[model samples]
Target: MEAVAKALHPDSKEKRYCNNEIISISKQLLVQVLELPFDSKSRKMTDLLKTFDGLDITKYANLVSQKLKINQDIYYYDNEHKNYYRGLQVMYQQENENDKQESIKTIRDADFEVIPQIDILVVESIWEDNKISHAFAIANKQTLTGLKFCPHCNSKAFDPKDKNYSRDYEIHIIQCENNEGKIVKKVKLDYIQKPFVPHIMQNKTYQYLLSNGRQHEFKPTQYFITYDLETVPKIVNKKFGKSSYQMYELFPLSVASTIRNKQGIKKIFFSQQDGEDFIVQWLNQLFKEAEQVNADNQYITEACTIDDTIPYSMEVPIVGFNSSRFDISLIISQMQ
Candidate 1:
């Protein structure tokens, strides 16, 4: 029974049968049986049963058992099996060792160059009281002769001398030349020398500015205009290679301004009304405001008092958020 079941198994190569092959063989047997006369059907069936009865089941089972035992014994007592496994293990270990050695050699041969350190002296000019400006870096104290130009007037002739040199600070005194090529101004700079670390050393002037930057007194601008523009999308038709397509383009729709002057703050809004172009109307309005501001006499009071008013005349600043890239470009394009 086991042999018969093995013969019928799908993956058994010795006696495998596909669905189509089995159907074809069954149809041939049926046709052959039907070709016989009706009286011989029972006799044919009896003859097929007798053929199966004559088969020796015990002999087939003995043959299969003998084959399985022979295979198991051969695998257990093979002479070179242990040596083959040992050779494989040694080969794998050798390969891993070779890879490790190659990686180590690559790391040893790689270039890891160290970056050179630079010794610099930062010079900060004491321009005004509590102010430090025109700061520059000079490399190496011995090469200070190459600094010929004055930081104030860009004069090619100037004299630099070491004023003071101590363990913490190194001060240099520079004599700058004027327009008439005369050394009249003596500029003193503070330089902190740091040999190990590269960083900006905060001097006395920098410390003072950090403490009193917002508290310093200065006169504010008397007149300035802050404005913004509003835009709307307008469908524009463009043609390319005899094909036309519509795309949305931005156009100025309205403008709002906050004017600050001597009188007070005044808010103004201009829109495209009565079929008039908004950009043209806004430009005309701006021109009139500029003329009015220019013609008026305005003075900014010094020290927050009207008693010390100073006459100021300058171009009024038109301020806007992100105006340089968008609003200013739109205004310039509309101008003549």
Candidate 2:
């Protein structure tokens, strides 16, 4: 499963280890090679690959056949997927196009042609202390045809491909393909400007880049003890302050951490001088509790676990943002 989904978990240090496409190609080939001795009536998704003897993996284990050159099997399938092919991801595009065509239909009777087309115009309401100062209005609109110009050939006749929509900026872009159906250029189209205003919901900013608007909400769980820290500069009376430092105070002099769990969120604050005392007491106790839970697998729930042994998701997870650098450093400095 890790070999099949390596694209989702990339390893920067070892680049070739998680080559998802190549690994998938190799595994698919191995499935075909190991199935030669099996009967069609018994073999299914794949033939069981197990061996009692221990030996190093040969090139034959991953490669299809010794007759073909190494470079020839680099990519198992053709770049263009026009029809059903084994181990080809692009083959499902035909099914998606069919589904799109089936969804669109026109009115059958001629009598319904009297229904006129009207455009709905949206305008932003001025928000002052969470109050709506403006209301929605409807108006007529002039429709404009959008045409993508190819950057490579400077041609107006082109199709959009590899389209991506950004919710933050509320824009859609695509690689422009010329009449020959060769993608060679990039073009952008903005859909939120003019005759349009973003709707404000619950006083939250309109996220134009997200396909589903807003980010995932934060919810606390028992397995992880999530926390965030706020820091401020240390200060003293000017009458006695000048002797300590000449230029500026660079270190975080005062730190406050708000931790969340099944109980609730609570904040603990202290001066830098008291940091050692805080770590030895509160943080140590929290770590001990987490260790006990992991030793007994108390964090695992029956629904998310496979039997009493394997868990779909179970960890003493340390969750934070920039905690690896700033927050962690400050805590470890006092601990050491």
Candidate 3:
């Protein structure tokens, strides 16, 4: 019990609280905490540990001792301070002995019968292009015979099912090509939802690339910009309620970006030397460049061409490596 309590200390960091009116544990409350359907002599140490998983054992032991009228002196190990509660060990042993006696009488009864375990069969249909497919079946282990055909290849010659299917079994369909023009194999278990496939395949930008046969490579008209920010810590005064304190805050010192397009690559940098609010200036220039890139790559339909495009516009993505907690926060602070 002491070992179990020590193991659970890290997971019990969150404090447990009861209402102010409930100062003591009642008999009904103790049964609820133990998660027992009724007051029984079959209490086990394992069940106690499981019930005490997220509780402050010190407080729990005190409450239980108060209810049972046990002396608090016997609750702890001698000279061990508050390290180990011995009363829990005493209660566990008492209940365990009672359980042993009860089990003896139960086994002697002629009506007592052992229950058999149920068997389950899980079948996964592996398909090309990363599609998710699963099926479940329950079968009696004593009567289930081996499957006749190979579930993967749909061939009768290759039977993958076991003759003794007396346990929970999982079988996979393998070596089949799906409708998405990809080769399916049992080893490749990447499963993607069925509904998302059409959205990805019929995206406007993807459709435009496919129509012009430029889907395999980056087109000359495509442009993307990658930017990064450098910041320094500046001490600032902050207030909470009636209290005020000083803390170091991040301030952007410089911003830089590399823009690549049909013409070539261009690098741009802005710093505090350029102006007091250089970040705002840099953001304005960034937005202008993104707009230009979107306009340059915009798809146009001719009179003879079909318009199957959805009501979606191309968006320019600004990416930064490890910027969410630091650089991005600095940018947002300045913007606000």
Candidate 4:
């Protein structure tokens, strides 16, 4: 995950977050801190530390306060020293825990940057031309090849099925040079919706240049994407007889490889890791990759199609074992 982060933003210097350690600490803290319930006699600042070992709850005051966004000034008062801690520092005390509502209130108050859920497939289609039709492989085929100049008059005919052309389909009867001019081939086309840009044949027949002793080539365009998954541990009786960590797995690999081999995928990238923070970092990288793929496609091709052109240029597939059960489930559940 850090490797891709570094690759995307060459200047990024911060060490990657340790997902496993954070999750473990967060879980332990939730139980210890929240269990006191503000009214418990055991609710003490020192007691809270005894439970949440790794977290500096005081620094999180800002995180919590910003989340709450209330007007109250939260500061730490050193009762024994007769002074208040500078800079919004609040020490956890037995009395402080008395207001479990404040902790809950703090969580509710802090200003957090919430990442909006993005529909990657929809997003990719929106940015590129005729992107939606291209993404629906079953509906449209040969996207790049579909737009070709009329062999006879050099006229550009829009694809018959493309919604851009509202006019009725027509059969264009043209003379076939292959058969003497007498033989005609019935060509059906959508003539109403013509692309703003001129369409050229991508898979042109190649010939050997006798003068240079070199072969001409028509390279197909391609794209790539990388993914990662983080899973929470769970014990289930479905697969294992005894209790064990049921790792969540996602099938992005199967989907990606299928799209690649079956759908003319040129390249694929798979970056696998464990834990939630890495997953967040991975998603950020994934979005950047998708954006880059769209940019590169538009740069070279006039009208790129998900069906005709490669889906990912630097296709990175992040596969995690048992991800389908855990990580995918979490994402789906969270979305809902």
Candidate 5:
């Protein structure tokens, strides 16, 4: 009877999987996720699908629905142009807004307060471009209606007394969902502008100034450590020379590690010879430092070339010169 089937299988529409099979699959997924070292906080539903590389997500969803006692849909958020995950989005029909067909504008226009809770999972290998790198797991909503103002106007100029003689002034404000679900007010953008800030990475370079016989420390994270090192060739271009010609041989390679310690200081690791070995050693230390904050493994080894091998095991987060462009690119290209 329909009642008998429903009682036996909570999520079974077709009565295919018995309760025992559903329970077993649920346990399997939990165990697999527990074994993975990848950060659970960073792993999105898309990443979960990728974890089961060969499995069809829709089929997997069906299995999960029966096993977990919930209906689910998957969605991916594209984060390159904005923040949050990219590709297929997941919606839980019963509790989430996806139960009813909704337009993109409805989702975008709804007051930030009504926006349903979402879990954006960062995805790897969205496209074929190697140079494109995600800075971090930045989770935030994108909005257009917060505030815009004329750059030439100052806040003091706006006075209630001058009703007729009004100044054409506007101010730019951060208009997005905040913890309190309110848009920020008009404020001077310059006040928040920090110099020597690493443009996209939210990092900054600071220093300690020994001025007038007094030591003053600027922004704690804005500092540098200086060290000198000799350089060697990591790559070479070979050509047959008809005649002997003078050419520049070895270039000096300096090693520096930026630490967000009491102050953002650049810790330069000076070496007499800047060769592959020295670079690798320095990277070992850098990687160790990054591990404290959980950076992605693929990005950390971005610079290693084909000649250089990915260690059988990742001991620490590696910081290498040109690792982003060279090492990561080479490895990804080779894999393809």
Candidate 6:
């Protein structure tokens, strides 16, 4: 979890509110200082911290205010303390902007202060006359051959009779290419997505990225997200289990993964209940948006359908022992 958070927000320095250590500190700090819970089991230990019910900071709100009064210079106290809440809000806004800038590797406009494209033809006309290289030339596939993701797919519904199926489908696509138009298999990928979690941002969901003024955009064929799920297994007796366990359905409860591109943009997503679909779909949208280039050859910065020219793909490798036989089978069973 720590690793996932770090990857997602690389510039983030502060510990998350739901981190195990942070939870431990919050509980200990409040319990020892304010004598909270008064019972042993109340200590927040041996727990995988989650966001909603993880930190119970309510009991110490007044205590923190009291302590703030002791250090007027350090804290916004008395008259200054009245505006402390508002000040914190401004700081959060600024921090979010900084994070956005850092994540996207923002560049300055002055860096591209070269001649415009209109004048490029004037230079190109004289380039051959002077026997020099020109900037307007294009690179041929024969000269620039590398990993080309194959767009062919074996995606079919697991239960062919079930028309209600969506991602209860399997993806067994192989990455093959014609190196300079000669057929060759570069890499083989066998992946599937089944029992897909309910979409996170289904209705009126808070879009964290959009809220922070960050538009999710990326170049196609440049990024890939590798992930898998931890599902609620139907036990022999269908007995209820712990933490990530589900009582009603075998849903994807928890997911964790790293999304990276060749441009040094790396992000991690880790969540429970309904995060898998959001992240997966977000990546698809990223490539789709990147492919929506205008007449000027610039990405239109809009949501779009999956562009076949763009390599929008995901891979799920077995995570644990017998996952290939158990977890993997359960997910791809519909396709079979």
| TM agreement with the true structure for every prediction | 0.29, 0.23, 0.35, 0.19, 0.18, 0.18
Error of 5 at 324 (Å): 3.9
Candidate 2: which pairs clash? 166-209, 167-208, 167-209, 167-210, 168-208, 168-209
Error of 3 at 299 (Å): 4.0
Question: 100, model 1: CA deviation in Å?
Answer: 47
Better of 2 and 5 by TM-score: 2
lDDT of 4 by residue, 1-336 (tens): 111112222222575445454444434444443444543233464475577433233334334233322211222335577533222322223234545666566668875322111000001233445432111111111232354223422223456557754342223323333433233457777768654532232212222122234233333444444333433344333455677445543432221211222234444333333333333444554556556555544323444534233222333343444556555664444331
lDDT of 2 by residue, 191-297 (tens): 75543435423212123223344234212345455555454544442344556543422355544444455445655655547763654454666566566445443
How far is 117's C-alpha from truth in model 2 (Å)? Answer: 74
Better of 3 and 6 by lDDT: 3
| Candidate 1 similarity to native, TM-score | 0.29
Q: Rate the local accuracy (lDDT) of all candidates.
A: 0.44, 0.37, 0.49, 0.35, 0.37, 0.33
- In terms of lDDT, the poorest run of 10 residues in model 2 is 66-75
In TM-score terms, candidate 4 sits at 0.19
Per-residue lDDT of candidate 6, residues 99-214 (tens digit): 55753453353442221111000011235465332221112211222212223321111333456433333232322222322245566555854444344233112233334454
Cα error of candidate 5 at position 137, Å: 57
Candidate 2 residue 202 Cα shift, in angstroms, is 40
In Å, residue 161's CA in model 5 sits off its true spot by 86
The better-scoring model by TM-score among 1 and 2 is 1
Tell me the alpha-carbon RMSD of every candidate: 35.1, 32.1, 23.3, 33.7, 27.1, 34.1
lDDT of 1 by residue, 180-253 (tens): 33346656655964344222123332333335562243334557788898777788876567776778777877
lDDT of 5 by residue, 1-336 (tens): 111122224443565666556545543454442454543344463476466434344334444343333323233444565533233333333334554435445657775314233222223454566422221211222222112222222111222244442432222212222314333467676766766635312321122122222223222222222223334544344455796444434444555565443334446473436554555566566556555423222222335432122222223333445555334433233231
Top-TM-score candidate index: 3
